[model samples]
Target chain A: MNDLPHGLLTPQILVELDVLERNIERVARTVSAKGLALRPHAKTHKMHEIAGRQLEAGAVGLTVATIGEALTFALHGVGDLFVAYPLWISDAQAKRIRELLSYVKLSLGTDSIAAVQQLARQLADKKDKLGLMIEIDSGHHRSGVLPDEALDVARAAREAGLNVIGIFTFPGHSYAPGKPQEVTDQEQHALGEAARLLRADGFELKRISGGSTPTAELADNSLLTEVRPGVYVFGDAQQFELGRCQWENIALSVASTVISRHEGDAQNPRRIVLDAGSKILGSDRPGWATGFGRILENPDARISAISEHHATVLWPEGQPLPAYGEQLRVIPNHVCVAVNLVDQVSVVRDGEVIEHWDVAARGLNF
Target chain B: MNDLPHGLLTPQILVELDVLERNIERVARTVSAKGLALRPHAKTHKMHEIAGRQLEAGAVGLTVATIGEALTFALHGVGDLFVAYPLWISDAQAKRIRELLSYVKLSLGTDSIAAVQQLARQLADKKDKLGLMIEIDSGHHRSGVLPDEALDVARAAREAGLNVIGIFTFPGHSYAPGKPQEVTDQEQHALGEAARLLRADGFELKRISGGSTPTAELADNSLLTEVRPGVYVFGDAQQFELGRCQWENIALSVASTVISRHEGDAQNPRRIVLDAGSKILGSDRPGWATGFGRILENPDARISAISEHHATVLWPEGQPLPAYGEQLRVIPNHVCVAVNLVDQVSVVRDGEVIEHWDVAARGLNF
Candidate 1:
């Protein structure tokens, strides 16, 4: 991979392999010491190489959002896989799921009784055991049934001969700055209530999974059996902005060159144009984000706009801006999505190039 | 490629060889009838297999946006390539450019004399053989020199001993609905003026190119030497909404399943959820776009919101909503970005599965 030559890195993401391993170890140790099962979400680093590393770091298993991701990790030799998203299984997808279940210990999520019933009908005669988790909506309204609705889903799964494993909730609202503690508490409350409801319905709740990166540190492990933190392994602009991580903790960045420069009007004095744009960094600026993303070398230079080929940055005063052809690294706002935008990432170790890892499972958004 | 088990097409994009060939033939024949040299941009369909077919369909050459893309194409034996973006070359990039120049005819675009000067310094010895195209800013204010400034850059390339081939511009404004004719007219005017300016500078302009899929149908071949249209080969939601293509012309789609349904309050009755969301269908909704993208089978269902894994669709009143586990095909707003978001596309031919072609260049965004 290193023989390909230098400039071959275009719209390329550079991940310091050593730093990534450090971050993974830090999170795993924290969760393991807290007596919580660590299941790093594979969505952040979709590559099998990273997944293998996480498993070696003492993670019990891996968490994925899509059936496609579950299949990818399973093929890569990951034994225990938790598909955290509430997935609807069509006839075609059911067949694929059954095949995946035979190869790995699979745990699926469902928020509704109908969904649980549908899954049960499909898995009735299958020899492989399928574990079903009742999804409870902690705070994020995207998916999951309310804590009160968990019993019905768990009952439905049990009736279908599917094992009613436990409950899981994604405290996505924890990503907002200063809200991690509150969201984590809410998550615990929701999961505890769901567990009680499932027990009352005569189902054994073996696990109560919760905690994203932002809330992992604040999770009350007494109520939860496991935690899933994806982006902690590769801190991004969002984590930095939320004060969840330090700059040195950031493991991935887009190494781009200053392609052009535009001295704006007196109102906007300093501006530099980068070869990295939305196509490279991804046009994903959350409403709360300060800019498109963050510049690693020049934090003062804010990304003002993003065209397909150029990233327009508004440089801060008193800072000498990057000249044309100068290289700079940028940490994207959302690292997982940014990683998905490229084919491979250069693994750098202590300023020297180590290897290039193919994002084998990239673009598997299905 | 087709020897895998009946349902082994897990995460890889399965391309029906016959469907892709038909799509390529249709677009090639359409442009051929118009007497325009068809040079499909490799940015959309990055697979070399598809590009080879385009070349076989009488496409003169391939158009790429990045040097990395050109290198990938060149590695796959595509000789004639046009790097369409204004590339800023550093010492590191210059070395790669030199290597590429050794194998293929490389035509690069530049909008500034300073950029041209840098290219000249890099290609000092091989200037006589290298190709340079001056870019004109036709309405999109993103990049490119003004038509009036094209001569200065062309003269700079000539002084640098590089061949001033022609001029090109991206009529990005053509993406707006109902503006294709106007954008095409503006593009032609800019190209014609730039050509005249270069000719006045005593430089022979061999290629005058401009045409996005939206403007291709309205482009006047009498004034240009070639036209580069990328998205026409596989029509997308943007094309369908802009009146550039019909429902039958959309050859690409995300086959997603309905995961949930919400029977809303009396004021808002029906809403269905799909597995596809921004992660699958890109969140590229121009202000004028109807929604994030469009549902191919259910035009009445409007995609109201897209969370990470859930796409909420508001069904029209009295319409039969898709039941849980029902599959729906979604045509994304921008085909290029959407295709780049996934590792594979299921190529369907006459409703029969065929070969699973890997998107080898899936994430070459850089």
Candidate 2:
């Protein structure tokens, strides 16, 4: 970054080394203290360096949201991976999974018996087996089956020669402020009911994987054998707003250059525009979000509006507005989406570039 | 696409070749009929195939939003290109532009005198000069100077040894429903006033580029010399909702496989989950957007919710919900964003995959 000119790449993703290491070690130590298997979701950083660092820091495995992402990490030598998405195993995906089985320890998530049946049909001839985890719907209501239906899916997986390990749930509702405890309770309740039902059905379930970024710190390890949190590796504005982390905990931000400024009205005399638009910071503002994103340097200045390639920040009156050619760090509302939008992120330490990690699984959405 | 299994590697981007060609030809013909130059914005599809075809259809050039995008197209033999963005060129970027100028006819958008001065300092030593377009603030206040400021920016560009070509504006406010005419008029008024001002400054502007997808068809020809519409070749739900294009005019969509289903409540019984999520279709819903996206086969079925890897479509009651493993076509809220989220798009004609176009400039935000 120092070698390049001042405003070359106007908006680029950057990771502070100290913040990143601290964030990773904090979660690793917490999960260790709780005696829970730490499986940092590879879906967040999507970089092999981060995954390698996570595993080196005592992460048992790396969890991912898709087989494609899992394959990317597996190819990069992440030996154990759990695809925590309810996948409908198509023939090609089944073939890919079978190929992956030869390289690493693989686990799949299933929410329906139909997907399990299809998996059974496709992988019946494969000699290797992949672990299956039935996704239990806690409070997100986006996916997953009820606890009662977990056994049925597990039964189908067992019948299809797949190993039913345990169950998992995403307490996604925890993303909102003041919902962490309620969402964690919901996660434990759902997983507990599923585990009990599975045990009653005579299934010896092992690895119970669950937890989102918001619920990772609050989830009880007694209920979940393993925890998967993606965004904790790169704290975002949402996490800060939800009180999951402090301002210093935000490890990732879009380094944008101020390109223009204009006074729309007399009262709004401090509107500074930056090149970090929705294309760089991403457009993932929840209804309760203050604005599109917040400036790390000027926390009070909010990105009042955004176009595809422009962030209009209505700077607060007290703080001096950024002039042309000035660089500012923008904390996006959702770091995961912002990370996925970029090809690489520059890892910095003490204001110096250390490494540029490629977002390897950036567009691997299949 | 037909050669693949029922549910493999979806939710994949699928483009109907016939529809894509027709849409392209329709816009090209419309622009030609008005004796206007067609420089389709490559930021939408980011495919060399589409840009090549647009040029083949009598397009004067291709318009892009970044220098990185310009380099990608220039390398692919796009001889003429325009970066329709207010760029704060770093030394590295200025060098990149210098390199790009060696390959093609390059013009850039600039709204500020500082950027003009920087361009002059960077390109002063170079023998070859690049065209400059002074961006006028239309209805969108994202970037661009007001009409009155265009001459100052143009004067700075001329002084800096840059050839001032024309004025341009992005009437982005036309995106909302019932705002096309107002936005188009805004575009004309802004560009007309800027052109008049620049002409009065003794500069005969040549290429007045303007128009976005919503205001493309409604724009007055005499007011602007060229039209740069990104999403016209692949209409999205936003265009459809704004009456800019009909449902049939939508040439691109995500081919998603139904992975799960559930009866949520007594009233909302039909819910089919598809593999297409925000990762594939992109998360770009505005406040007024209808659901996340609409299903093509079942238009009434709105994707009520979306997760990172799952789209839950709340199928309207009285219609039989799609079974598991069924394929559904989803029209995303914005085509440009959705296109950027994928690696490649499968081109289809007669229910068969004809070719695959790489999103070559997918993440070229720099």
Candidate 3:
């Protein structure tokens, strides 16, 4: 049992420093071995301390989901940052982007001609300071243009006096069961096709970024120059259930005390309520997820349901039910969303809290 | 179209003041007419401004889900407060609860003997000032004990020298389709049975509380002394889909700009990506929810998928897709979770940003 800090609040986020350091080292080592620049997505941990550690472990830059996040890291003295989402910049964002460029080497992703035009109109004076990456649709179909259409976006970006640096795609579909390798193949093909088209059109594709947590290790180094994988640093239940990572790799968990418990009859099963719920753990259960989340100590137990402040964990039958007030560690379904839900996390080593890291960029999704 | 403020950030929460006031007024008026006290659940909005408005409209107190939340409101001068969840108080919480009781008329819910004993042990000196409400299991089996078991808990509270105030239950099952009325009936019966048992056992049942957003209006005035409904002030997509409220009733929405849009092929449907994803809109789709959430203007449209920073809105087939960079209001699946995700909300009046309210109690689920 982890000895939580005395008077530690329930539903508090606990980052296991040893496990976190190992996870970061392993990913950094693997990416270095493959000769791919690692831009660990700061959106997962959203902590300056973690970002500093990633940079120390040889990360090229930090990948973020929003310009607000980029600015946060830039202000915190992180020199290189990439806002990896297709941002539809407002006048405020355009100004912020300009301000960010003055301090850090910043790049942004663009998927449409309209966005490129808007960016040019908003930041016309600072066009040379901005670097754009044309987003390719690979197979996720969430954002990004089709691989064939990447050239049009690149041409528009160049014509509008914006620097088109490269192409990128997020194989988000890799999150599904047994689909990482297949998604990585699609990612490589998409990047390869986009790069070829852009290159044929006299565009020097300096960067070809692709990868989510599931496909990060399987990234084709020959085709992709960089990879942006967020959730690997703090492996979540979704990653664990998808067989992408093991329980030992999960570096972050919610320290929640059991508040209520019930032994069911014929129709129902034994259950316990944890102080941790969607408010802290977040409510991001993918369709393929086993349950709401996983109880770290009891792999067989499932977090059956969650409300704002109550996670109803279905205790595995015959396993001793944890006594009321006993604290347990719960791995959330999606670490990125979970991390965004908190303001700070307890950095613990050997079951003792050593420091607290502010989730400085949390809720900065502008 | 609502004329938003210039340079307004995407995925920013915008709470319509007119609609919010109306929603609050309507609920307070209804509960007043029904001769029941209204304790608006502050967990939904977590704003002192909104809580102040609710109190001005005639709320007996504010209902909170955690001691942290209660403390937030109590410190903000919300004189009467109740932490309505079955809290397993720690030493820190007990100390905080005692501090809370020193200023506010604070009450807490208990369902188990262990929790009651823990409370007694921790707050022995403050027993006279502390109020305990035994939570009765209505139809929602999430928390609370069986209605018949209320007497035992009340006895335990009395034995512990704690002030037993009443009994309460959350008819959470009302959130489903065709379940509100039935669940309200169950709530009445449960409260009535529990009150009867406690009164027969010489326990004074001064405050019988029950009601969620779906069953708030239908609450039996003779049975429930007070109704605690959190979501009525900001009707969500879930409430609308469940036929609990109309589109006009929704007061809170995420102001998100369209970042990317694509015309679908044979395999997929056309979609637009909104900057408001789970991080801002929240990922709380109940089993019966129509989609992730509903768009205010485009009611037919569905938020088909969401990542941490992108809400993939599947636009209606014939509806003209929103232009790139156009801002739209995206109602979250659950308003409470969405409110908790942000630090502040832009309070809009007559389509103009008037003020910003801090989400003071947000993420205060300790």
**Which structure among the candidates has the greatest TM-score?**
3
Task: State iRMS for model 1.
Answer: 3.8
| Candidate 1, position B49, lDDT | 74
lDDT of 1 by residue, A1-366 (tens): 112125534557888877788899999888888999999999888898899889998999999988778888898799999999777665667888888887899898887878887777766786238887878878765567778777777777766778887889988778786788889888988898888877887888888899889998777578899999999988999999999998889898888877655454453345777778766677666668888888888777788677666777888877776776677787888888777777778888767667988877776665
Candidate order by lDDT, highest to lowest? Answer: 3, 2, 1
lDDT by residue for model 1 (B1-366), tens: 122223322222334465457778987887888888888998887777789999999999999988778888998899999999877777667888888888898898887777888888877887876788888878765667777777777777777777888889989878887899999988988888887777877878788888998887777678887889998777887888899987767767766667777665553336787878767676666767787777877776778667556777888888777777666666778777767776566666656565555666766654
- RMSD per prediction, one decimal? 4.3, 2.4, 1.3
Task: At residue A207, give the lDDT of candidate 2.
Answer: 79
Model 2 Cα lDDT, one tens digit per residue, A1-366: 222224436688889878889999999999899889999988888999899889999999899988789889989899999988888777778878888888898888889989888888888876246788899988677778988889898888777777888888888778887899888888889899999999998898897878888888887678789999989888999888888888988889888888887766652345888888877777777878899888888778888788777889988876666777888888999888889888889888878777888999997887
Ranking by DockQ: 3, 2, 1
Candidate with best DockQ: 3
Taken over the whole model, the C-alpha lDDT of each candidate is 0.78, 0.84, 0.88
**DockQ values of all predictions:** 0.31, 0.58, 0.78
What range of 10 consecutive residues in model 2 chain A has the weakest lDDT sum? A1-10
Docking class of 1: acceptable
Superposition error at A199 for model 1 (Å)? 2.3
Q: By DockQ thresholds, what CAPRI class is model 2?
A: medium
| Order of the predicted models by TM-score, top scorer first | 3, 2, 1
TM-score of candidate 3 chain B vs. the reference: 0.97
- The alpha-carbon deviation from the true structure for residue A311 of candidate 1, after best TM-score superposition, in angstroms, is 2.8
